[model samples]
Target: MEKIKRIEPFHLRKDREYEPFLQFILKILKEIDPIFHFENTVVSEDRIDKPYVSLKTIKKIGTTNQGIEIIIEELYEQVAYDIAIERIIVRPYGLNVDLKIEIESTRDTTDQPYLELRLIGDEIVNNYILKLFTQQFQQIPLDNEKLKRELLILNTMIKRRQWYTVETRAKAILDNFPEHPQALLALAIARAAQGDLEKGEFYLSKVLEYQPENCDALYNLGVIYEQRAEYQKAMRLLQKSLVLKPKNHVVLWKLGQVKEAIGEIRDALNAYQEAMKTTPNPESKIFTSTDFRKEAKEAIQRLMK
Candidate 1:
């Protein structure tokens, strides 16, 4: 038997159009199999346009009359408002398949959400099931119970500053629904805060997989790289994120830090000045009177000397 490696979920950046794409995929997957349980489901804003659910799961067939339990590992990169489904399926005992499903929804606007379903191998039947599952899911209303439970766990971890526990809980959620973008993001943040920059990068990468234009994920990635002394990579990612949210003070501040680390004193000073310009009044409290600011000012003054 070939070793089964766990597949990672798609990265949906905070500022990308991921939800509509996710929804389109979920609708199709639901149509494929309603009984298939998904884990690590994440929902968040995608490009300020719509909310999307990113999900992942291990699919299994109940013991049949022949007593054979068929298990298939699958992953999806999709959106909520979009009707496109891009999936990869691996069945050890059978032919492996990769498919893209495109569906056009006539019930809405002329730019109907098109669904893209692909069959890479013998998984065409499974694709059909995805179509059926989507139909059924549409009839059901949104259920926030699962989300509430996950959020509660996250809140507890945050309040206690149990960063490790937060990551563990988030991972457990992903174990069941690996495509959950919010869980991925939260886990990334928790990991970074816990000083596990590598793991955080892994999670942040997942966010980028789905939402290429996610400014938050990019910024976070830049921070992680900067911490690791990967100055050039950090600069590139931070610059990209800044392009999307030019007024983001946090990004500016971090860019300053990266520049300072790389000995670009002038650039660093400019970045800090820019950060101060856009920083909100309430937020300024966090950095205004601290030793950190004192050190920063002293460093800038020394740069002049």
Candidate 2:
């Protein structure tokens, strides 16, 4: 693997000159190394635009002095109405050269509209370094530490919210660490809140694959199944969770609901009574017993017939 020496950040203006600037950069990269491939790219000029766009490229290379390989993975873009900007991070593995280039070009009147670049690594010959000295001397400092801090702040903001925040942060985390079960569960909760029940179930199942015996996952899966009227599956999962946490009044209450839905009135009544007994407060007592007791009492009175 080639060592990355410098990573540059560029900001492009959203004005009418954006397309030409992008083309110019593309031309420059292709001229330097015809095998160069962009990692992420996006273009948008409308408000009702999708947040993501996918791009695929097939490059044809002629006979070169040395063998070179280029692989681009996960190229995407997020575009806004006034700002059609994209970021591309390239990893050149076999290159033994380090160089930095910053191109700032804009036709806008504002001073903030400029492209920034930093030459990362140099495997090029010393002669090339001397030739590129002027451009290298003008390189801007890359604040990667500051950027990391900003990303952490953004992720924290997502975790503190209800639906949008959780899903966004969960995805951001998963992008970096796909196998994190807690992040999957957080995404499931967010999707459930957003009424995306199918996606929520998928995420919950993923969490269960990592932690099959997780009581919270089992209980929540049971609730989702019950909502979808899958009585048998709901009952089995709720019961399994109850076996793990017998004193959980909420699970007992859910078991009662499932049993009642399945026409097992006596079993439902028993479950409800157990739930009421485990509940900690008077408010919970009313909540667990009011309807179950009424139904049980009515059944008993009819049995006297």
lDDT comparing candidate 2 with the true structure:
0.52
Tens digits of per-residue lDDT for model 2, 1-63: 122222121121222232333444444455565665544323211232344553322221222
Which candidate has the highest lDDT of all?
Answer: 1
Instruction: Report the lDDT of model 1 for residue 42.
Output: 30
Alpha-carbon shift of residue 99 in model 1 (angstroms)? 53
Cα lDDT, model 2, residue 201? 92
What is the per-residue lDDT of model 1 for residues 1-305, given as tens digits with 9 covering 90 to 100?
11111112212111113335344445544544454333432322122123354233333332221111111112222432342232323221111133333322111111112223233323555545455534533322214686667766665665466654566556656756677776787788887876678879999999999889888789889989988889999999999988987877777778888988898989998877777666432332122222234444555676667
CA-lDDT, candidates in order: 0.54, 0.52
Model 1 spans > 4 angstroms off: 1-142, 152-160, 280-299
- Maximum-TM-score candidate: 1
- Measured on C-alpha atoms, candidate 1 has an lDDT of 0.54
TM-score on alpha carbons, each prediction? 0.45, 0.43
Residue 63 lDDT in model 2?
Answer: 24
